[model samples]
Target: MEKKVQQYYKLKQKQKEIEKELAGLREEIIAYCSSQDSSDAELGSYKVKLVVQNRKEYDDAKLYETLSDPEVWRLLSRADPAKVASLVKLNVISDERIHHTYTLKTVTLLQVDKK
Candidate 1:
């Protein structure tokens, strides 16, 4: 058990070092691609392609103020888990009702830390 723990710790340390080096290389590659103004490049047997992704975010309060229909806001909004949990704790919502409404899951993880 001790030997396995030691091996796992050593592997995790090596992984962190490798990830740090990879992060630096990734930045350099991105810089090179931007400087050349090309999305695709080839080096020896490796081919690199730059991918651009865009995301849209809206302000909920502003959206609500702009919208005429309350139903539209209701359609866009979903139940918040934290608020539901608070209701359950306050006894406003019964445990049986919560159990029927949502599926509960528990996750277990093992973490090794250097002392």
Candidate 2:
């Protein structure tokens, strides 16, 4: 009986941990969705529309295939700054505002050009 009670408590604790992790993940998704790039406002509340102009799914292998090209970074560096700004304005890239210290490194590797 005591062993069964301990097992039951352990199961409950594990369930609570899973729930907490799931909630954290949901918050992360929300943060990513309503990120600074996606919507911006100061002080009071404001409405912003988010539209996914293009959507496609890539599995782990396909994702690796898309990301493993070394030439991509070189091409990005060679792209026009103005065009990169326009692309950012068009929401072509993820809109997470990185810190200034990591700015050059992060932006150069990815197609995220700050406007």
Candidate 3:
């Protein structure tokens, strides 16, 4: 048991070191790609590319108000767990009402800490 725990800790430390080195290398690659005025570069068997992504944020209240159909909003929206839990605690909703609606699964996670 102790051997497994020690191995887990060692692997986590190695992962952190690898991630740090990758971030530094990624910066250099991006700089090179930008300086060349090209999105892609080829190095022997390996190729690297710089990608740009755009994400959109919407005003929920205005969006819903502007929508012609209420069903469209229902189809797009999902329940928030924190809000539901708060409502249950406040006696606004019953646990039995929502209990059978969702499946419950158990997940196991391993975490190692240095002291």
Candidate 4:
């Protein structure tokens, strides 16, 4: 009877540990999903452009194509929002001279939750 009691206590302890681990994993998953969702929203419609003087004799301009939603989400999931915003600002500054560069601005469309 004593042996059985000890076994039961051990099992309960193990169960508690497992439950704690599961809870931690659940939180991590939730965080990951939230980040992915944010990224998906950001990448849905984004663009950037560059304007620079080439050879100091001619003005050269370049446009960086926006990534697809999936790609943008994948990237945003791993990127910091502040960093992304900073890059966008930098691009805007660099391309300020070019009128078309305004079109290259990044626009984050908010996702509406459907009930």
Q: Which one wins on lDDT?
A: 1
Better of 1 and 3 by lDDT: 1
Deviation (Å) of 38 in candidate 3: 0.7
- lDDT for model 4: 0.44
| TM-score of model number 1 | 0.49
User: Residue 5 in model 2: shift from native, Å?
Assistant: 0.7
lDDT by residue for model 4 over 69-90, one digit each (tens)?
4544354443343444444576
Identify the runs in model 4 with alpha carbons over 4 angstroms from their true place: 38-115
Cα RMSD to native, each candidate? 15.4, 15.5, 15.4, 19.0
Tens-digit lDDT track of model 1 for 1-115 = 9999999999999999999997777778877877998777776667777766432233445444543366644544634555545555787555564354454444222222232
The residue pairs in collision within model 2 are none
Candidate 2 TM-score, true structure as reference? 0.30
Deviating ranges (above 4 Å) for candidate 1: 56-115
Clashing pairs in 4: none
Kindly state the number of residue pairs that clash in model 1: 0
TM-scores for every candidate against the unseen true structure: 0.49, 0.30, 0.49, 0.32
